[model samples]
Target: MLRKLPLLVGAAFLLTAGPAFAHVGAGPVDTFSHGFMHPLSGIDHVLAMVAVGLFAVNLGGAAIWLVPSAFVGTMMFGGALGYYGWPLPMVEAAIGASVVVMSLAIAFGVRLPTIAAMALVGLFALFHGHAHGTEGMGLGVSFLPYAAGFVGATALLHIAGIALGLGLDRLGNMPATILKRCAGTAGAIAGVSILAGWLAT
Candidate 1:
């Protein structure tokens, strides 16, 4: 449908842009701007974050917000742990796995009670947060502003995902369902690729 044009275009842009900036590292995060750009720089993070939004939308009802909220809140806790130099084993692997789980859920149209959904996303958020925290530790920047920037950017990515989900829902039929599934499949492939890269490195 004509309505899907912009969303498709945006998705295209992100897909193309992601690899060029992928996980460049936290070395540049010496300011709020740098912190904000950190997540955007990584394809893995973007995929997982957007998948969270899609998963929330698929669940419908309060899950639309609750799931993302849980992720954000718990992610902050994980970030704090990272900032304090706490050891969280397998953080990178966990993050990659989150992408696989979330995207597969969307692809299969998996539904759960709001509480369960929140817990699922929250669990993944911890790994994501820890990554940010660990990377940000020695940046010598003001923690509050840096945190705020990254959090704000994350929220924006979620909103973009939700917006796409909502647009598909508006189509109100098999087309929407197919598109959602396609999105999920693409996400799944991305997850697998990230995990593979991690293994190689």
Candidate 2:
């Protein structure tokens, strides 16, 4: 549990600070940098991306890679919709909901079939990608690099979650399970806090 303190603290910080969609209009800058920074700028993105990784580790097996892949791939497709100005209703709300659902899944040690897990994360990724896409609105040619930047950042965050999850799991089954649940419960509370913040705003 001590080993996981930093990550838990960071997640808590995400819950307490930053805008829901801080990436919506990143200023003029290198497209890649802009995109890369977007995910880091918001609490919602960090929580959801990291939670996907935790969920993957909880599922175990091929799901470790497949689930994250599903999210990234589907997220890109959703980004395209946003880039093209296709409307996705309730994107912010959906993103918040994703955090709540995914974190709770981890908290409870819920294990769905690999395909179902993939689909669940993939569905969440759409809204995430759309948020990224819509942010790059007029970037035109720069959108690709911006998209790449965010994708790269998302992948890194997922890996971090996986590493932390795996590390906790190594502490012995019961201890690991307890720690993961504690982390997930914190994440779920944070997610709810974020949603309430959004509603208040």
User: Which candidate gets the maximum lDDT versus the true structure?
Assistant: 2
Give lDDT for model 1. Answer: 0.76
* Candidate 1: regions farther than 4 A off: 1-25, 138-141, 198-201
List the global CA lDDT of all models: 0.76, 0.79
For all candidates, the clash counts are 0, 0
Which pairs clash in model 1? none
TM-score of each: 0.83, 0.85
lDDT of 1 by residue, 12-40 (tens): 33432222223325465556787687778
C-alpha lDDT (0 to 100) for residue 93 of candidate 1: 63
After superposition, candidate 2 runs with Cα above 4 Å error: 1-23, 26-30, 198-201
Q: After superposition, how far is residue 54 of candidate 1 from its true place, in Å?
A: 1.0
On a 0 to 1 TM-score scale, where does candidate 2 land against the true structure? 0.85
lDDT of 2 by residue, 1-201 (tens): 323433542453445434455445646534788778767777777888898998899889999999999999999999989988999866766677677778878887888889988988898899889877887777688668878998999998889888888998889999999988898898787777776574321
